[model samples]
Target: MIAAAWLFGVGGAILVGIGGFFRLARPALLPEDLRYLRRTPDEIDAAVPSLRGWLRLVFIVLGGYAVATGTLTIYLAATDIRNAESSAVAVLAVTGASSIGVMALVNFALHSTFRWPLSAAAALWIVATLMAVVS
Candidate 1:
């Protein structure tokens, strides 16, 4: 159970960290499947600056929050796996569920492509939360 929790927690952390990094430092890293990135090269180049510039601060803030939460889950799980504290499990579950909800909302609102990774991470975190609780 501890091993499973650790694996899921670390996997979630890595995914969230990578997402946060891309959002903060490399908006151009947006997946090609994203609706906003489906334009021609010239159009994409012309639009990337304005679009990314406009959302830069927002992305940075949200990304930072996501990274922080993900890191917190990893740290907490690593430090106290034996007890499987309820508070820690609650936080992990809440954050995981919140991430899924927020990502779904964002995808609906902006018609973006952030759902896939968010869904994946959310699933892992949810499983980790369950494992922690059971253990």
Candidate 2:
């Protein structure tokens, strides 16, 4: 169970980092960005100068969240979760559902190219959830 927790955290952290880097690096982050917007970053900047900055800010916040999620998961695993505390199980479940489940849903809804990989990462969430329950 602890190993599963660590795996989920590491996988989620790596997966979440995708496109976040490109998002701030002055390029369209994902192909979905262009597919959904139908415009390049330059076009977006030309039409709405502040929009890109706002997006960057949002991604930065997401980046922070990515870090937090991984850290929190591992921290929980190293502590209360190992003892099979109900509260720890509940907390971990909530975190996984809110973060990985929601992210996977959004990617699927958007037909994001990253959807498959993100779904794989979310599978880890499910595995961890089950292990937590069985433990």
Please tell me which predicted candidate would have the highest TM-score against the true structure: 2
Candidate 1: C-alpha lDDT: 0.64
Give stretches of model 2 more than 4 Å off.
2-29, 40-42
Error of 2 at 58 (Å): 1.4
Model 1, 1-135: lDDT tens digits are: 677568656755764675578565756435543555557656755766566556676677777777776677677677655466677677667766676546655665665566676556566666777777777
- Model 2 residue 48 lDDT score: 87
Q: State the lDDT at 18 in candidate 2.
A: 47
lDDT of 2 by residue, 45-114 (tens): 7898887667777777776676677677767776777666778778877887888778889989888886
Q: Pick the candidate with the highest lDDT.
A: 2
How much is 123 displaced in model 2, in angstroms? Answer: 0.7
* TM-score against truth, every candidate: 0.66, 0.79
Question: In candidate 2, where is summed lDDT lowest over 10 consecutive residues?
Answer: 19-28
Alpha-carbon error at 34 in model 1, in Å?
A: 8.2
Weakest lDDT window of 10 consecutive positions for candidate 1: 28-37
In order, candidate lDDTs are: 0.64, 0.70
